[model samples]
Target chain A: MQESVDLGPEQCTLLLGAGITGRVALSSPDGPHIVPVNYSVVGEAVIMRTSPYSVLGTYGRGSMLAFEVDWFDHERWRGWSVVVRGRANVVTDPLELDRIRTTWDPQPWAAGARNLYLRLHWSEISGRQIGVGWDPVETLPVRRAV
Target chain B: MQESVDLGPEQCTLLLGAGITGRVALSSPDGPHIVPVNYSVVGEAVIMRTSPYSVLGTYGRGSMLAFEVDWFDHERWRGWSVVVRGRANVVTDPLELDRIRTTWDPQPWAAGARNLYLRLHWSEISGRQIGVGWDPVETLPVRRAV
Candidate 1:
């Protein structure tokens, strides 16, 4: 085991853009819940579509949420994680929705009438990579969409 | 896209036991944060070690937190996730420490003085699998160790 290495802003943003799915951590009435959702990174904000009855749909609007994307290698005991913390808002504007839909839209995996779209405007981004000298971005199995 | 299938207790426990790494979501003064850690299941409780200043070590004790483990297949548009909602407790008993040390102790990946051990006693466990019928455990790239 080795001390984790802090990732810079560029590294954090690149890692977030590489993955299509990430976990969103939000505070609910019961407690904190982490739910995995497919998301798209447009500018610095994360955009996702969920059902109106879902946790993110219900309590995510105007709330501070943490979005995390991570991958680990058990063989080498190394992992890299990026967390984006910010306020979420419901995207109702037709123009903004059109831009996202044409460029990079988050396609929901679960089947339903997902009319609610939430955009998490990131205020803070941080990450860490564990293990010895190695470039996690180069070694990552998943690559950014071309 | 398809409707998510609810997983039963037996399936959920089996899935949780299969993974060595998972994300822990907890509430702090700042907001909700998700941190990935290597963990082990001793019966129904999750055993983990973290630094005293770490989020899990500081605010997690006696706090209701949500722990999640999941994997996704982008090509198939499928994934499975198991969530454990519970109250976390610090492990101080010498005897209990010995038991965990002897069997399935969580091996912390980040090197540091991790003197604090936290156990999350699950009060509620639930899971969901999305996409057409398929065993996520079977299709998962990472298999359980013998």
Candidate 2:
């Protein structure tokens, strides 16, 4: 079995910056809720836009949430995953919203009035990579026999 | 802006069967956590394997969790996402484990002693799709200009 490696803070941050889409997990009154989101990282915070009535928008403010991104190369049987635990806050300041709009505008693919922008201030960031010695680009022919 | 459509239970099940990888959300004492996982659906339950001491393995049993899967077509600015809310349970029956192992062998890429298998019994299933009239395969030339 190939070994898995933990990624450092700097490497996790780099991976977060390179990602465009991720899943955000939040606790709701009913249960744990998660959804796919388009996001942008700004100054150690993850920013996303959603409808005010959406699950994320409703329970996001001052709530503890987790965001994750991952890449998997199926043929090579290797992948990397990053998780960010944070407190989410609504971006209400006009100047800050405008600055974020100008710097990194997030366009949510789901068509709706997604005007509310939430910023998650990360308290913990962790990452892991599987199949340490495998080449991501190379396809393994041995798997074909299975 | 394109219209968004809600998918019915049958369509949601179809989408779930088509996906192999998804993110699972669980609430921990610290906060809500989300991670990517490889899973398979069998008899209305989603099954995945993980290390016994892992966060998911430790906290998943009898806990309310959310599972999500999505497919995005960036070129056409369209996608579909499905979310399943369920309670997780550990598969302890040797006969059932053997059945699952024979039917849908979950080969987790992350190398470890992942002998524990968790099954999620879904209570709610919902799905949504963006860009109702747009073709998923058609490339939009307007995106190139930006």
Choose the strongest candidate by lDDT: 1
lDDT of 2 by residue, B1-146 (tens): 55788888888887786566788999999889897888888778889888889889888888999999876665566787889999999999999998888778667876678888999989999988887875422422111111
Winning model by DockQ: 1
User: What's model 1's TM-score?
Assistant: 0.96
lDDT of 1 by residue, B1-146 (tens): 67788999999998998888999999888889888988988878988899999878888988989999998887788889999999999999999999877778899989888888889989999999998678877955566563
TM-score of chain A of each: 0.95, 0.89
Model 2 chain A poorest ten-residue lDDT run? A137-146
Q: How accurate is candidate 2 locally (lDDT)?
A: 0.81
lDDT of each: 0.88, 0.81
Give the alpha carbon lDDT tens digit for every residue of A1-146 in model 1.
77788999999998889888899999987889989899999888999898889888898888889999998888888889999999999999999999888878888888787888899999999999998688878756567554
Worst 10 residues of 1 chain A by lDDT: A137-146
List candidate 1 segments past 4 Å from native.
Answer: B140-146
